[model samples]
Target: MASLGIVLHASLICIVLLTFFSGTASRNIANEILQRLEMVEKLNFDLKKENSNLKLEMIDIKGELKDIVNEMKVWMKSRHSQGNNKMNESNSDLQKENIKIKLEMAELRDQMDNVVRENCEMKKKWNELDDILISVYIHLNKSKPEIQSGIMPEHRTPLSYQHVAENRKANSVRSVQRIVPPAPDVTEQPVAFYAYMDSYHTPGLPIHTTLIFDTVQLNDGHGYSKHDGVFIAPRTGVYVFHWTIQTEVHSWESIEIVVNGSPIGCAASDTLRINDYGTGSGLVATRVNTGDLVFLRTHESISGYLLSNHRLRSSFSGWLLYS
Candidate 1:
């Protein structure tokens, strides 16, 4: 019984010790699990904080990217606008150049037309001159026989000359007629005039009123009237006319040469520059009938003094080019 009791006591002690060890081990495992849970929670919290920080940084980066995109858009827009403006300017310049070229081409065409007309006129004049030369040759050939015979033709004597010869001694009259040559050829008289403004013409000359050249330098054919400043065409002919105007400082004047109430030429003098004198001249050629009136008149309202002096004289001159 003692041996059995000892065996049971040993077994009881082993069981108690095993139970305490088991309890202690369970407590340690529970504590270790709690520590592991706390560590895991801390790690999760740190990860979450890091994630939040990363999110904030990503948001900031996104905002910066958006601002950069907006700035790039603005810069690109400005560049596009500048390019468009340059293109518009180039287009305008091209348009201006095109217009200028068109005008130049028109002028060239006008010059060509004038040249063609002048060539045709020259050809006509040459044909007429050839006809006149042929006629003159024929006339000379017909007069050759009479010239060789050395006899005066009957047609050469005037009726009054023949009567006078009959009343006088025939020999003496014949001798006098032989000594005298045929009458000289008569030539057409030339028509020309030149005049100047001898006095000052103040401002406010009425529009369309005639401007009188008070001094006459030349008045051949007596067609120019200095008092009235008019030229009456002496004969039917083509005439050339020229006029000059002078203006004082800061003055403006306009004039036109008129033929029978029709404007033929015009000129203007503007001396708006400081202490400057302005001068203008006009020239025209036109056909006029006998007794047609030609004069100078104001084209527009005069604004300043019309200066005429020894150095600079406003003058009018005209001449018959052909009849």
Candidate 2:
């Protein structure tokens, strides 16, 4: 009974050990399968993500293609429009060229016709002139030679008549010569002091006198004198006096002068001073009337002073335009 009991206990112990080992192996197998299933699930999730991304990229590509197609259509339409415009322009230009050519041809034809007409007219005129010239020549050739010689028949003249005619012609020529006055001497007034008295003056006016001095002699100290001034009645008139003073020095002051007292005409003074020794002029213009006196005043004192080759000349000429 003791040996049997020992066998039974050992048997029970061995079965319990076997059962525990089998359960451990089964647990390991189950864990390995579960790990493989988890890996597969992760791979599927990654594939789904990749597929979604690819779909989005495809949509973008399709949109770009649509834009390219639209742009192509627009470019084609523009090209077609441009082609139509070019064709119309070409047709219009051709019409204009044709019209211009026709107009030019018409103008040329008109010019040719005008030239032909003028040529005919000129030829006709030339022929008529030629005929006239021929007739004139023939007529001149037929003229009498004796008449051309200026001779007359004796019956046309008497000796006494001829003598009287000649005498009358001589008398007529002499009469014509007498009627025509001789030319007044224009030779410059004698180179000397010329004086005119008021005796030849008009009434109610101071005697107007003109004195022309050929030259002023500084050596003689003869220039302006108090009494030299002219007296004219008081009246309104344009008075002009010109005095030309010539000197050897170009830079001389107060060479020519004129002075007027009360009721004097417009008074003017002119002086010419050049840096070079040449011709210079001085002028004075004044309006004066009756009882007015004008005189020449000398400003410079020089011993060698003498009127230039032209000589010192003083002239007073004026008329009373109004009283």
Candidate 3:
């Protein structure tokens, strides 16, 4: 019985030991499970943190892309504006050049017009000169025929009754009658008298005097003295007159008669002074018309006595007189 009891006690001790060991094992297993849980939670937290950082990197990249796009747009707009400006400047330059060319063309046209006008005026003057030369040539040619004809006679002679009688005596009456008179004589009265006297000298005679010109009057026989020193013509025709004068000394004295400021006749004496009286007498028969004023004029100082002789003459010679 004692042995059985001891065996039971030992078995109880073994059982207790086994139970302690089981408890220790169970404790270790629980500890291991708790550690494994802790590790899992840490790994989960790490994964979540890495995911958030990746999301932040993606947002920054998107912002940078937006800025690049905006910059490119601004650059393009500036380029476009520059291009438009260049085009406008080119157009303005072209317009200015065109206007300048037009002005130059207008000036050239004006110059051409002036040149053409001058040429036409010169042509007209040349034509007028040519016409004048042609007229002069025609006049000279017409006169050639008259100069060739022998209708004119030679020698100058007076055609009067006394001249005819003398010619009849020289040649026979038949020959004298066959010869025609050179000029025809007509009876003419004095219309106006023109007298000229030399300058007055202390002891000299007058240079010239008119005899018939002083004696004849317009209505009847009336003589004119030195006081009435002028004569006016009443009618228009040729008149005859004679002049005579005596000088005691020789001198360069001249007398001139002018009508309408034109000299018609003049007498001059160029002789030395002498104690005896010297006479210088002449007859001037001139054809004077109406409206002619006659006066006396002298060239040098002279003074003396004047005497005129009555003589009849013809005034058929050519003399210009104003009417």
- Which segments of model 2 are wrong by more than 4 Å? 1-33, 142-323
Q: Give each prediction's root-mean-square deviation over alpha carbons.
A: 21.0, 28.8, 31.9
lDDT of 3 by residue, 229-262 (tens): 3333333455444444444444444555644333
Which regions of candidate 1 fall more than 4 Å away from where they truly are?
A: 1-187
Error of 3 at 229 (Å): 68
Local distance difference test, each candidate: 0.70, 0.39, 0.44
Ranking by TM-score: 1, 2, 3
For model 2, how many clashes? 12
Worst lDDT 10-window in candidate 1? 177-186
Which residue ranges in model 3 land beyond 4 Å of their true spot? 1-50, 133-323
Q: What tens-digit string does per-residue lDDT give for candidate 2 at 151-232?
A: 3233322223124324433442111110111112213211111222221111111111122232223111111111222222
Number of clashing pairs per prediction, in order? 0, 12, 14
lDDT of 1 at 140: 48
Q: Is candidate 1 or candidate 2 better by lDDT?
A: 1
Candidate 1 residue 30 C-alpha distance from true site, Å:
99
- Error at 128, model 3, angstroms: 3.6
